[model samples]
Target: MISELIANAVVHGSAGLDEPIFLWFEGSSECLRIEVRDSSAEPPTVRPVEPEDESGRGLWLINELALTWGHGPRDDGPGKRVWVSIAPAHMGLL
Candidate 1:
């Protein structure tokens, strides 16, 4: 899940191909959160689309499957962080 989102941000969010993208993951007993950072300050426009359309839709899937998701300013960068949180399966008992 994190891989897909990070890749999408790299491919779509950066102002240029050379711009850097960052990925972060944190986990807790009840949930897992993933953040993808890019050099663009604009928030990503994630929307639903037909599965066969074949041009967009990654973020839509992320929002659907994750428990909660959003974006915010980076701690010390000019860009923003797009994030998603998912409830840990099996209640983290495993």
Candidate 2:
């Protein structure tokens, strides 16, 4: 889950930017939120994937694993944040 979110930030959001990706975590044993922020203004999207495609499944995987997921423009900079929420059990923390 962390890899997918970071990869999305690097592949889809950090296209030629000098800024580093910002990672954040919040919540408790019941639930946790992971946020990946990158220096691109473009939003992330989940497009249709075919059976033979080798990629384009990161967001799909995130959707399947996360309790909830979303992305939006950064509140403090010229970038965006893609985030996911998941149960602690999924993280083996419970």
Candidate 3:
């Protein structure tokens, strides 16, 4: 899940190869939250997938696996932060 979020940020968020991407993780007994921040203001979106499509399935996977997910303007800069929350039920298997 984290890898997908970071890849999406790198590919869709206009981040340069050397640009910094920040990840923050927070967890409690019942939930875990992951945030990925990159240097683009453009938000991520889910596109309709064709059966033969070989790409563009990252967001779909996140939606299917995450308890909740979203993105917004970065609190620290000009980019955006994409985040996902994993419930306790989902974390146990990890």
TM-score of decoy 3: 0.90
lDDT of each: 0.80, 0.88, 0.90
Ranking by lDDT: 3, 2, 1
Q: After superposition, how far is residue 6 of candidate 3 from its true place, in Å?
A: 0.8
Ranking by TM-score: 3, 2, 1
Clashing pairs in 2: none
Q: List the residue pairs that clash in candidate 3.
A: none
TM-score of each: 0.82, 0.87, 0.90
- TM-score for candidate 2, residues paired by index: 0.87
lDDT of 2: 0.88
Candidate 3 Cα deviation (angstroms), residue 4: 0.4
Error of 3 at 15 (Å): 3.7
Tens-digit lDDT string for candidate 2 (1-94) = 8999998888888858677999999988689899999989898888889999999999988878788999998997888989999997875666
* Model 3 weakest 10-residue run by lDDT: 85-94
| Runs with alpha carbons beyond 4 Å of true place in candidate 1 | 90-94
* Clashing residue pairs in candidate 1 (N, C-alpha, C atoms within 3 angstroms): none
